[model samples]
Target: MATIVKTPAGTWKAVIRKTGWPTNAKTFRTKRDAEDWSRRTEDEMVRGVYIQRSGSERMTLEKALQRYLADVTPTKKPSTRKAETTKAKQLILNLGKYSLAALSAEIIADYRDSRLASTSKHGRPISNNTVRLELALLSHLYTVAIKEWGLGLTFNPVLNIRKPRPGPERDRRLAGDEERRLFAALNDYSNPMLRWIAVIALETVMRSSEITGLRCHQVNLQKRVAFLPDTKNGSPREVPLNETATEAFRDALDNPTRPNDCDLIFFGEPGKDGKRRPYAFTKTWGLLKRKLGMSDFRFHDFRHEGISRYAERGLSAQKLAALSGHKSMQQLKRYTHLRGEDLVRDLDALPKRRPTA
Candidate 1:
């Protein structure tokens, strides 16, 4: 049963007290509304489906995100934590005013459309992958809120909306003479580390971050292996190096400019905290690429080039996956773009069968 009363403020208050349930109450501007809510709530309680949404109704998205950053983001990897913090700022700017209970599928879908249509600060159109990552973060936030934080959200609105399709894969391989010209320019650059990083990536199929973040102890020229304790796929790998890669690692390790206090092979200048971090050369790389008239060439393409070369040399998919740290064959396929001429050459090398008799 429920009790209804009119307060001096002239609002109707409905209070429900059942034998097995905790007391629940709500206030409404109209008595009819109060009676309707009380009936619905009591029915839900009887059905054993009642969830107290008062907290969710009062908590805004901004507050929830703040709590998530403080409580959840720290548990993730450092790179993941940094990326999610950036995405959180965008979510706060766009949807922070809405309460958890107030955000609907329609509202989130509209946000998706607007974000896809928006442009980045660099004047380029926003990429589908960027929006997808942002949406993923939001969806995870909802999942955490409902399951862990007990926010009383019935369902995630993001799950009900369509995610943006993945963008087209890049197949840009080094054209003839482009590689020679690029390396010649790198050798001439004032910084020798850039050339070493580029050479290591081409020879070992290692990612730019993995190569740049290397420590002195991670590489062993004697063993011809580089031990990666952390990688993009969340797996540690020991990348076997060829002669070229081993020599590059040796040169980088024996760098005359190597600092005594820093363990990083490619250490940057001291920061405000007086701590040396991994070298960051994104601006320099971009400027150098533009100057070389290869503005479209990206550092990541070196992984693709290396993987394709390995595939052409008849390496098994299992071996390629081990070297590249790819968990799935399908994902490894994206990095392999074998030249048609090389395939034809292999086809020609097969022994001719005797004519059928």
Candidate 2:
């Protein structure tokens, strides 16, 4: 049974009280709308399929995202945490006002399209991979809210939605002339560590963060191995050093700028509080890129180049995986794009075989 009353403002207030269920009430501008709502709610209650969506209705996506950032984001790796936080902020800006209950697949698809259509601050179009990552964060938020946070969502809106296709794998590797020009330009930079960063990256196939985050205790020059306590995948790995990498590390250790105050090999100057942190060479790298007119070259490309070079030298997939810290063969394959000419050159050395009877 339902009771519909007209208040002083002439709006219809409908209230439904059912046994074994929480009382649901709503104010509507019209009596018919109030009647309709009460009827639907009562029917849902009778069917035992009614979820108390008060939490979902009251909580906006912005609030959910903020809560997720506070609770779940910290558990990820540092780089992942930072990236997810930024993506959460972007989602809030785009769909903050919508309540969790109202976040349907259709609404999420619209957001996906909008993000795809818009250009980023860097004047580049947002990649499908970036959008996919953003959607993943949103999906995780809903999962956490339902399973742990007591938000009674019947289903995750993001689960059914078609995710954007990821962009093609990048196969950019440094050419001989390009490499020469880059190293020549890097030599002109004031920071000697900048050159060492590039050299070690090409030789060891280590990420920029991995290279920068090295502590003196983590390196074993005699063993020619660098121990990474914190990697992007949250797994500790021992990266083997080639002859070039060993020499670069030796020089880095011998450099006069090697700070005694901090354990970081590429230590920056002390801040206002007199704390030294890992040197951030992004700006320096960018300036060097612009000076060399090689705008497409990114520091991460060094990893790609190093891995490809290793594959060219006849390293097996298993061997490459161990050296590169790649857990998945698929990911390793992406980094192992050998040039057709090199393959042909190897094939040319083999003698032609006759058909067997």
Off by over 4 Å in 1: 5-11, 352-357
Best by lDDT: 1
Return the top candidate by TM-score: 2
Tell me the deviation in Å of residue 5 in model 1.
Answer: 4.1
Model 1, CA-based lDDT: 0.93
- lDDT of each residue in 1-357, candidate 1, tens digit only: 789999999999999999888788889999999999999999999899999888789899899989989999998888899999999999999999999889898998999999999998988998989999989998998999999888678889999999999998888899989999999999999999999999999999999889989999999899999999999889999999999999999999999998888899998999999999888989999999999899999999999999999999999999999999999999999999988998899999999988999
**Model 2 clash pairs?**
none
The clash tally of candidate 2 reads 0
Q: Each candidate's lDDT (Cα)?
A: 0.93, 0.90
Tens-place lDDT digits, model 2, residues 1-357: 999999899999999999998888888999999999889999999998887877999999999988888889888888988999899889999999999999999999999999999999989999999999999999989999989988788789999889999899998888769999999887887888999999999999999999998988898999999999888777899999989999999998888867666788888888899999888989888988988888888999999999999999999999899888999999899888899999999898879899899
Root-mean-square deviation (CA) per prediction: 2.1, 1.7
